[model samples]
Target: MNTPPSPPGAERTDGSSVRIGVLAPLTRPGWAEAGRHLLAGLELAVGEVNGAGGIGGRPLQLLVRDTAADPRKAAAAVDELAGLGVAALAGEYHSVVARAAATRADALGLPFLCSSAVLDALTEQPTRWVARLSPPQSRGWQLYADFLLGAGHRRIAVAAQPSVYWASGARILRDHLAPRGGTVIDLDMGALTPTAVCDELVDRRATALLLLVGHPEPAVSIVQSVRRDQRLTESLIGAPAGQPEFAEWATSLGDDGAAIPFLRYLPERLSPLGARVGAALRERLPEAPSFVAFEGYDTITVLADVLRSHGPDRALTADSWPHVAVEGTRGRIQFSRTPGISVWQWAEAPVQVVDRDPAAPDRFRILHAG
Candidate 1:
């Protein structure tokens, strides 16, 4: 095994190190906590790899940058990381940021592994140095639609804020459910109050309401308002894996958070490794590890595996990633070389519908597995 020399800023006096650049929304308004969870998972994986003698006797060090969920910031971060000689890049939570970072990574010809961005277009084309562990937004919506119809929901009304994330989710749901004898109603959450939104859905006789707000506070408000109405209390209130998976969302909503089902990357049953990772994460994080944390951990572990097998050569790592498969905490971390989705994309990660326990907001129950 011919180990390549360490990149520019990665060579230490005592020993060589492989610097992995991590891009996350560490200080972003709506995504601060998500970024923290992502960083924590990455750090945990790096610690483990270093403890196990690292890759080829070179310890892994994370050079983290806060993208603030902004595309321009993400691009700048990539440039900085490249300048610092990072062997690979990973760990982004926002779709917009991930897309920008992916483009930059390809341009620089550096291997980049996306942890949790779900936009279908991110990996729509073949690229030299890009792959995603998270399922695309379209795939997630497919699972959500399946769960909804299986749970006997027909007249579905979607209330979503105006954002790329919300719009993509809403579009997928409408496209999947409309042709299946399901009535799909679209409401701009920005234009309606929680009360007005509830009234309109009730008037339209909606059996289910998909609250697609990105922010936790407003999502909780809408859920609370809708549940307060006696007419809407029986309605299946659901969110599309944004604020719903966060602990703060459930805690702020209190007892009202119960029974509000949401799509997430949690499997129906945790693997032994997944359980151990979850337990380890719980010790460090204020909340139990969510899907974002799992993504970060898996991304680093997969990157480590690639580095160990391919050495620190950027081109070799990029070329070899497509054939590399690692068992991630969520599931198998493998990429599909399909035409449209031309990357190493794990599109079949198990997603499930889960709801918070009213008595234990930190706990959740899997309602439906997809």
Candidate 2:
């Protein structure tokens, strides 16, 4: 006989706890390490909120579902979580997965505070039901572009898989660099082997290589090949999607993963609150936490504040995006309608271009900040 399935997230029948549904990539192909850190931040914030009296003493609880980086899985999770009576929804690390969850949450009229996905067009149409803490892709990638140009790179090549996020990053670089006498060559990772990528780099004379692909497979292979290539010795490798932010990259590639500048949302100095949370997150996670963990903490903090000031009613919580004024681990958190973005975005989340020290893989060095 098959084991019975566990009922999702609707654990409290008496309505004593205010539930917030969490969507994350906790399994394979979903960047599980990032998911772990994101969950850590969310869990930490919930504990603190409960300790301080949660949502007017009712307590806040998280019902987490693993999206595993699948858009369809995330959409289905939104439906299930909304039906299970969550007051709000939060947490997703992958851009495409978050987009799916945001669309579904908007359709169901469930309030969603997106934690980490930065896709600019989160929803096809603007809706008050979703707010985001991360900076949009366009802004972050353009800043990454600025960093490349500042470092005297003009001829660039991107090794990319078939992904909207990858395509968008390539497009952003091409658009930003074209007018400034810079050129971008796109290499299809689906067709090109890692050696082929190095060969293409040599033939094309591209000075820089960007990895706009997934982690640990193609990305790792490509980096190893490029690092070992004698011809591409002087070329630079980059990952603007923040692939090197996690410890796994360092563990997987060692010094090969270091010095590959990527975009990260962080200030030069952590706030007093950020400092405190950083210590707490360090204790919670086995490895040092990424900015994603901070994003997760800030997500619950904002949602808890919304519930306290407005109420747990979904409509009011959705409408409360404009009134959120919490001090997040990153910086002051607030949202507004950006011109092209379809959701309320935290307009002032910090952005930086950083890379690990080749000498000390555990230490990050800020190359550029904006």
Candidate 3:
């Protein structure tokens, strides 16, 4: 809940700091830790950039606000940051918050770069000032469907939390796999006990279980319950992307988390630059870096590139973003106007399916990549 103080508008005495506003859910019920990790990544990138002489010899300063995962709060945060006269805007994890921030940024004509919010509708319009670095939820779901079908999973059982994000992801999964002759069984985790859910899945002869829970505790509970039932040993259990992308989700599940597949931005093999960044991140945070952190890092890195190429002018910053194509930790950070996606989005963001090792839960092995 402690928001960073806003930086002085581009008119500071030194006139050598480029201020960028970061809007995230730092104290929201379900988004606190994720937001913290995101901030860590952003700070790391800022440190790296500053060490390299910054953009056009101007140090990048981040002025952050807590959205608390609320749409109205996100919009207000954008307005406040704009009032501070930031050169550009970035950082948001929740889709709903991102949508609100995106709308406000477009209206204000501020360049806003979204990180890790997967809602398809975020990019379904022609908002010239808004761009996203993450692929849409539909693409992620399609990847999940492809993985399931390739693994010979036909009878699929889905257990989803009642959050709007989870519900939308579950719907996308069902819509994608059902048309391919896969038998989809939907269960609301909020209305059913884990034991009962497992029993039904077992009784229905489900070959795969897709968990769409976004938070850590519930996701761990369901995974533990499913793991306890010996009948599901051969069944493929997937956490999709959002649930298991957090370090807490895997750590909370502990050894039982092994072999449960999930989507991630980092590949099993890291690029040379990625290895250095990963080491830097591990040294700073108590836990290993999650995909969200990588996303935050990439967001700032790309933003810096934009500022460097177009200078620190706010108007030029907004104009140069659509043409940005810089390489980051994950892959090339490029924004193209795609139909039904954000006006300028990195539609081909690389994602991979990975599972924790049974012997070492912290370590993971890649199952698929695209």
Candidate 4:
């Protein structure tokens, strides 16, 4: 929606190119860094697909729209893309933006293969039109909860911003942690400054502080305050939304960013295919690729396979989720109906609780895996 609307009846494929619409947060308030890496992987895959004879010799094309983390922008982009007659849709990083795009794509009967958004309630009801490649937020956050308990963190505080995604993550942490003698508290980032957050941690005697807030502004500020506060020296800090996964976090905070654990969708060891993709992504990106970039590559890989199998028919592409058995950059990709998740889900995407090493800020240390 941040971009201009496509011309009326814009260039639908006619044995020329097989187009797929891509929705990514590429501008302000959209985590543009992640978007850059995601697009790198997606474009890389598209080139590779074209190299290997794309969709009966038609090149795969991407009509990318920038959502900028806005739901309305995403909805508009979905309408515009559907109007352009794309064979399928792919790629979105933010859960809320992807949710909006999914709702519109479903009503219009367009097949969407979501890349990186992990919210559990992607749709209000089960629908075949949408399928996701990321692990659900509940599943990933619960694994984080287990990691906390295993590390002897009982009193945890979450610095949360006002958003459905952050709220869902905090709820998942609470629901999973409370029965096992753990307590969760929320510090409103809207009302509290970074120094105030440090004071609250000291006053509440919290053993761990989880950032459910946005990055570089409040997240970076909060980490600086907490790390500097001598009163809470023993307290652990975490970011379950994976803010620490990017290079910007390290650039802004340096060694202060180390040891702040977060959820990442990657295995302990890369498979042969994964290693090859990682090397290619590092060449394409300014920094080593995060799991998000792998997610982007895998998204296009699965879509290209599906398109090759089903051949550009929209309804048939939507129906093909359950039958997809392609190998992804992380693992084998497939979709199934998960209880309460109203879309086809990749139930086996790997997740790890990892952090930067204090000694080497550029390196990641995997603490736990699930």
Candidate 4's C-alpha runs over 4 A off are 4-15
TM-score of each: 0.92, 0.97, 0.91, 0.97
Q: What is the lDDT of residue 57 in candidate 3?
A: 84
lDDT (10s digit) by residue, model 4, range 216-324: 7899899999999999889999999999999999999999999999999998899999999999999998999999899999999999999998899999999899999
Would you list the C-alpha lDDT of every candidate in the order shown? 0.80, 0.91, 0.80, 0.92
State the lDDT of candidate 3 residue by residue for 119-219, as single tens digits.
Answer: 88763367778888888888877787888898899898888777667778877877888889887888877788888888989889998888876566576
Candidate 3: misplaced stretches above 4 Å? 1-16
Question: Which number leads on lDDT?
Answer: 4
Candidate 2 residues 153-245, lDDT tens each? 999999989988888779888999999889999899989999999999999989999999989989999999999999988999999999999
Model 4 weakest lDDT span, ten residues long = 4-13
Q: What is the C-alpha RMSD of each candidate to the true structure, in Å?
A: 4.6, 2.3, 2.6, 2.3
Better of 3 and 4 by lDDT: 4
For candidate 4, what is the TM-score?
0.97
Worst 10 residues of 2 by lDDT: 1-10
Return the clash pairs for model 1, or none: 335-344, 335-345
